[model samples]
Target: EPEVTQTPSHQVTQMGQEVILRCVPISNHLYFYWYRQILGQKVEFLVSFYNNEISEKSEIFDDQFSVERPDGSNFTLKIRSTKLEDSAMYFCASSEALETQYFGPGTRLLVL
Candidate 1:
């Protein structure tokens, strides 16, 4: 079975720095999304991308965050400027039909 894979799995960043987490979604999917969960918080939607432009974004998606599909199977999320509160597990999801979203293990981001 195909799987969504994320790099680093965990990252340590300093406040006010930049970090880019990478993901590779399963093949043949069209829509990709980014969600985050703070240590004990609920999963929150950050943004969704389809056709290379953002399809929908939540209020939590501020100027500091951006996403891209750099290749056929690779999706990336960039935190332009990080903050301590930005620490969370960033999950990458993809769905072929928008009804079943598959999630990766996630990239745990820790900002000091």
Candidate 2:
């Protein structure tokens, strides 16, 4: 079965450093998105990318964050400066339509 894969399943960084998490969604899925879950908090939407541009973004996606599909297969999310509050599970997802999304296992990011 086709599925999303994320590299560096776990990441740890010092506060103020930068971090980049990668994902490879099912090849044929057309839409990509990034979402985050702080330890005890609800899942939050960060950004959505399509056609090589941002289609939508949430308030959480501030200047410190960015997303890209540097190649045809890999998608990435970069945090220019990590903060302790940024520690969370970051999930990448893809969907053929706007209604349903298939999510990656997620990369666990820990900031100190």
Candidate 3:
């Protein structure tokens, strides 16, 4: 079955650098999203993208974060400033429809 995939299962970064986490969503899906879960905390929605622009976003998706579909098969999330609080498992998800989303295993980001 086709599934969303993320690279660099775990990343250890310094407290003030840029990082780009990559993902390849399901080929046929129309909607894609980014969600993150701080270890032991609730999963929080970051942003949703469709038709090449942001469809929706939460407060957590501040100026530090950006998402893009750089090609037909890949999507990416770039963080401009890494903060200690930015440590979390970032999940990439895709859905044919809007409500139900299938998530990738997740890219664990740790800012030290």
lDDT of each: 0.93, 0.96, 0.95
Regions more than 4 Å wrong, model 3 = none
TM-score of each: 0.97, 0.98, 0.98
Which lDDT tens digits does candidate 3 get at residues 39-98? Answer: 999999999999999999999899999999999999999999999999999999999997
Task: Report the lDDT of model 1 for residue 46.
Answer: 95
lDDT, model 2: 0.96
The TM-score that candidate 3 achieves is 0.98
Error of 2 at 74 (Å): 0.3
Clashing residue pairs, backbone N/CA/C < 3 A, model 3: none
On residues 1-112, what C-alpha lDDT tens digit does candidate 1 reach at each position?
9888998799999999999999998898888999999988899999999999999999999999999998788999999999999999999999997789999999999999
Give one digit per residue, the lDDT tens place, for model 2 in 59-84. Answer: 99999999989999999999999999
lDDT (0-100) at residue 60 of candidate 1? 92
Question: Residue 25 of candidate 1: its Cα lDDT?
Answer: 87
